[model samples]
Target: MARDYDSQLLESVAVRRRRMRDALLFGAQRARRSTDERLGKVFAGIAIAAVLCAGCVGWSFLQATLAQQKQQQQQQYGTPSAQPSSASSASTSR
Candidate 1:
């Protein structure tokens, strides 16, 4: 009878050990899933911010180029009226 009791006790202990291992594995899997979700969100936010920054830089460059073109056009076309007066004054003086 004593031998039978010892064998039953050993079986119960083995079952308990297996249950504990299963619980630990389940908890570890849940933790890994949560960590992966958090990392994915962080990377997505970084990608969005990078794209916005690039767009802003491109817009700034486009504005600067347009302003330069406008200035060149004004210099070329806006000075013609003044040149005729200057030439007439010089001819009168001569």
Candidate 2:
């Protein structure tokens, strides 16, 4: 009877240790999953910010090009001359 009791006690202790190990493993896995989810959100935010910055840069370049074109057109056409023509000399000589 004592031998049987000793065997039962050993079995119970072994079972308890197994349960503790399983619980610890489950907790570790849960923590890892949570960490991964947080990391994913952080990476996504970074990607969005990068894209927005790129868009702003592109817009600035476009605006600068348009302004340059407008200035070039103005320079090409120029403003009307302010001086009068020199036709009076030819007409008087005729």
Q: lDDT (CA) for every model shown?
A: 0.91, 0.83
Per-residue C-alpha lDDT of model 2 across residues 1-94, encoded as one tens digit per residue: 9999999999999999987886776565776766888999999999999999999999999999999999988876664222123455556778
Give one digit per residue, the lDDT tens place, for model 1 in 1-94: 9999999999999999987876776565776766888999999999999999999999999999999999999998889878989999999999
Off by over 4 Å in 2: 1-28, 79-94
TM-score of each: 0.54, 0.53
Q: Against the correct fold, how does model 1 do in TM-score?
A: 0.54
Q: What is the lDDT of candidate 2?
A: 0.83
Poorest 10 consecutive residues by lDDT, candidate 1: 22-31
- Give the residue spans of candidate 1 off by over 4 A: 1-28, 80-94
- Which structure among the candidates has the greatest lDDT? 1
What's model 2's TM-score?
Answer: 0.53
> In candidate 2, where is summed lDDT lowest over 10 consecutive residues?
79-88
